[model samples]
Target: MTEPTSANADREVLQMIPKPATAPEIGPWLWAMEETRRGLLRTVRGLEQDALDWRGASGEDNSIGSLLYHIALVELSWLYEDMLLVEPPADIVALLPHPSRAPQGGLQHVESETLAQHLERLEKARADFMRHLTPMTEADWHTFREPPDTDYAVTPAWAVFHLVEHEAGHLFQIREILRRWRAQERAAP
Candidate 1:
């Protein structure tokens, strides 16, 4: 038998939907969410506070800090309100006291927040989500919530998928914002 080359040994295998050893039922969902979180973090890593707070030329209000905060807030909201059907715990509430969007329908200001602080909030929210999700059985993953006075019902599986999509969409926005900010800086005299 031929020996495996070092290049082959060092090659990274990408799992599109990885299964968690402990909880195979929702493992794929968890893996997708983690991938989204990691992508967002990697995109923002090493960014200074000014970069985090930069806005586009049109005065668009979704700063990297606000986007980061919004991502965490929306994930926590979906996990607690939609999946678990419970109020968010006190710690999470404290971490995100304001609404994700202002009355004007723009992202709320996450004022003076450092990249470390935004990352911490994101990590905390994900940890809480995983803690609650880890124990769910296959049945729980398919369980649906039909809130009062609402025509729609949602399942935990769908909620998790939504979280992944939500993060990805915002991460795209963040990349564009970073690109614009860098371009503007380079154009400056």
Candidate 2:
């Protein structure tokens, strides 16, 4: 695992604020998600096709491309299923062509798709999610959905928080994978 670095105390803008021109009530959450996503994009920037598709020698772990697809899929799923209390709309489903999990109960391994395609899917999912959130009222933000099939309920706020953490965790995994892949490439004869 990578070690942490100290923040520069002199930096002027270390605060978290809502995204600009967004609803004041939900802007903080939006900003947090955006920042988390920025970190994700930074971590994966400039990855080539082999880097995106690389699985460790064991071939059991997810490829970076798979993780990227999973991230986008989960974001849209949470937005529609947990927050909106409905099935994902047709367009959102269209954005994710694969099922969330494979028949063997792992993240479906995504391959062959270019990094550009993965980024496009992520961008579309995020844009749709933000558009839905931009007009939310305070009440909408707090309202909880309790699906009968599950024992738990979630407010939109909680769902957004979960989404942020979920993506952050995967971003860490992607970083580790990239590091390992580079080392493997260098060691190859």
Winner by TM-score: 1
lDDT of 2 by residue, 58-95 (tens): 98889999999999999998888778877877887888
Query: What tens digits encode model 1's per-residue C-alpha lDDT throughout 80-142?
Result: 878777787789899897787788888897868888888999999989988888788888788
**TM-scores of all predicted structures:** 0.90, 0.89
Error (Å) of candidate 1 at residue 137 is: 0.4
Question: 27, model 1: CA deviation in Å?
Answer: 0.6
What's the lDDT for residue 177 in model 1?
93
Q: How accurate is candidate 2 locally (lDDT)?
A: 0.88
Which portions of model 2 miss their true places by more than 4 Å?
1-13, 20-23
Assess each prediction's global lDDT (C-alpha) against the native: 0.85, 0.88
